[model samples]
Target: MGWRTVLVNTHSKLSYKNNHLVFQTGIQTEMIHLSEIDSIILETTNISITSMLIKRLVDEKINLVFCDDKALPLANLMPFYGRYNNSLELKKQIDWAQEKKEEVWLEVLRQKLINQSRLLFKREKDDQGKRIEEFSCQIERNDPTNREAHAARLYFNTLFGLSFSRQEETDINAGLNYGYSLLLSIFAREIVLNGCRTELGLMHHSQLNNFNLASDLMEPFRVLVDEIVLENQEEKFKQIKKAILALVQNTYPYKGHLNST
Candidate 1:
């Protein structure tokens, strides 16, 4: 239930002191306990951080996301051995059958499409929403029929406009990509924390992709980013980026109770 997300966007000297993150910029100084932090976003190029702080964040299993000059997340720091017996989890991950992976991926697709359908309904596109709902149920193992693509076409067109395409290099696309990258980094941290491999994936098997498993696990959560992009189409600001990153704090139904990512 750790909820604090620290953003270090300005030029500052950051280090670990007395189990607290000490930030000193000019004459102003701030201290935050490590236990209160869930994640840290390094969004500036001018900031300097000590190795001790990095090691502490890793040891504490706190997510550390580094952003590019554009203020978009580019990389993250994840532990190689998050569990006591990391080898055992690696064996379990490899032992997972293809059928089981497909089954899990199918459920993920269903939930993603269902969320897309709900968003469509909220936008007053009832027919498109129902079509997406039907496709959610019809999706087979690994989504062989590619209902997700069809649903995406309908969803984006209805949500934005007929002229809007996800491929387009626009503010909306940038925002979605940024938010999705943040979500991917969050899932990557969780996966590594559980001794899971981020390179292996159930459905997103890409040889060039290093975060395939995170991509698979983050599929359903992409809709949350899409919602943010749709709501802030006028402009893309740091506030919008922070809002998308805060999606991890929002509670969602899991098992029988609501949980935060």
Candidate 2:
């Protein structure tokens, strides 16, 4: 897989040339070999890309994310056939046992809750953190009682303020939404790269959602975004966005070794 994430923020024209991605702007032109790009984020609507480049991106399994006018991720382009055994993987996904799915979902929720509580504790909100940790233990299979939602309410309220609601129009909400979208796109890319369907989810079953599995898998990573947003509340959205994007480079202990997302 490619290792670089190229972000197109200004007006530019993108095209495929000589096995490279040609980026042309009013002042200069640059070329990056296709093999070096893991993904491309178009943060401006003023850019134009050729169909040839689009085809090359798909063929190389490079993700392409499009952002809205406000510079928030809106949609992404994913490959239809990600691997040679994609049909087999699809059949396996379709045949996943309900009990197994529920079990996996429960584990995912528990990890997410643990991460949230840890963050709260780090911020010195011990009481709320303990409450969230307790909720993790109480979570049932498939989260029938919705302990996740309850914990989220308490967690967000404590972290921001009692008056805070995720639906409200605020800078915090904007940062969180943007960070989550970036995480979702990364997870979706990995899912498709492994020949799994992004629509089949363990817990998130929204009919309108195209990336349900990505949503489900990204739960544990949400707190990372929250931590960055909380620390950089005074910074502009662009700076916060840079920090969130750089999260992929941060190393963490996983399964007895260090790993990066």
Candidate 3:
């Protein structure tokens, strides 16, 4: 009923048929319809999208997301679905996101906490609780940028099993930051579609905190990030493509029924 978000992995085949994005599965190929899709997400070490396809996607107003080795959305293709400032529904969605900002923001925070705790437990029940506490405090701070900055620090520390410096702001890989930014925007768009305010954020700008709701809401889905990262760190990414496909195709209950939509 909204937008379709598709995730493809390393060296995966992507051909658009009408409004479909297709890939090979074993001997059979699977397809995701573009008209039914809100966004297309790709993540992997060796990502190669054809020029012709990319142009077509742009012209069609379909959002195309590129993810990095870390499986963070690196780039996105934005939709031109509205005319200038005359888009009434877009404005209403924006207004609604701002209206229900508090509840949405808090929900994001609580989910983030729960996800982080689950991650730690999954790794080792006796891991460092102190680190989790610190990460939680940083994420809950009144600045979304601060949350990302600090969260990246904590995340990398746990990720690479080493201490990280606050002074570093390196991209996960070359040309990858672009994709992650787009994916982040896609997530924000999803929040807006869910009838939550993308602005009036809980931990974002005081002047105009648009997309903070998106920032808050992406907590549970952060596992998608972790799953991508894990695959990249593997000796050989045999499962990287499979993992991405699984993530995008996986379903669960949201408002009432079980679905990834």
User: lDDT, candidate 2, residue 233?
Assistant: 74
Q: 1-261, model 1: which lDDT tens digit per residue?
A: 257888889989999999999999997999999999888889987889999999999999989899889888999999889899889999999899999999898999999999899988888889999999999989888667988899889898988899998888887888888889889999998888788899999988899999999999998878888888888887756556766766766777778998887
Q: Kindly list the per-residue Cα lDDT of model 3 for residues 230-250, writing each as its tens digit.
A: 446452333444444454446
Decide which is better by lDDT, 1 or 2.
2
Structural similarity to truth (TM-score) of each candidate: 0.94, 0.94, 0.52
Off by over 4 Å in 3: 1-62, 66-74, 80-103, 127-156, 164-185, 189-202, 206-213, 235-245, 252-258
RMSD of each: 1.5, 1.6, 7.2
Give one clash count per candidate, in the order shown. Answer: 0, 0, 15
Please report how far candidate 1 places residue 41 from its true position, in Å.
0.4
Q: Please write out the lDDT profile of model 2 over residues 1-261, one tens digit for every residue.
A: 677889999999999998899999999999999998887999999999999999999998888999999999999999898899999999999899999999999999999999999999999999999999999999998778989999999999998889999988878888899989988998998999889999999988899999999999999999989998998877878888887776665667888998766
Candidate 3 local Cα displacement, residue 55, angstroms: 11
Question: Per-residue lDDT for 28 in model 2?
Answer: 99
Arranged by TM-score, best first: 1, 2, 3
- Please identify model 1 stretches exceeding 4 Å from their true place: none
Please give the ranking of all candidate structures by lDDT, highest first, separated by commas: 2, 1, 3
